[model samples]
Target: MQIILNGAATEVADALTMAELIEQLKLGGRRLAVEVNAELVPRSRFSEHRLAPQDQVEIIHAVGGG
Candidate 1:
């Protein structure tokens, strides 16, 4: 499956849910928002929602600045 992550195009295995991607990418507790194909993927739904091919994923990690 091909997906454009952030801005780069990459290929990943299919049947992957948002939560699985997070773990696969080793993204833990980043305190960010996840958007898949123009739709916001709620944290609670990440585990259940399956990502499709060519889906656009934008994960914005929260940054602390003063």
Candidate 2:
């Protein structure tokens, strides 16, 4: 399946869930926010949110400031 992740086109396995995607993206830290198709997805729901073709996923990571 094809989906747009963080403004890039990516091909992933069929029936991949958000949790899988997160791991694939190497976002194991807790300082990132995930938004799927314009909606904020909670961390607890990552495994339950299944991704479809052309799905838009925005992952934003936070940075420490002085």
Error of 2 at 62 (Å): 1.5
Write the residue-wise lDDT of candidate 1 on 1-66 in tens digits.
Answer: 988899889788898888888988899777879999889988999999888888999999988999
Model 1 steric clash pairs:
none
**lDDT of every predicted structure (CA atoms):** 0.88, 0.90
**Per-residue alpha-carbon lDDT of model 2 for 31-62, expressed as tens digits?**
88889899999988999999999999899888
- Residue 4 deviation, candidate 2, in Å? 0.4
* lDDT winner: 2
Stretches of model 2 off by over 4 angstroms after superposition: none
TM-score per candidate, in order? 0.89, 0.89
Model 2 TM-score on a 0 to 1 scale: 0.89
Lowest lDDT 10-residue stretch of candidate 1? 23-32
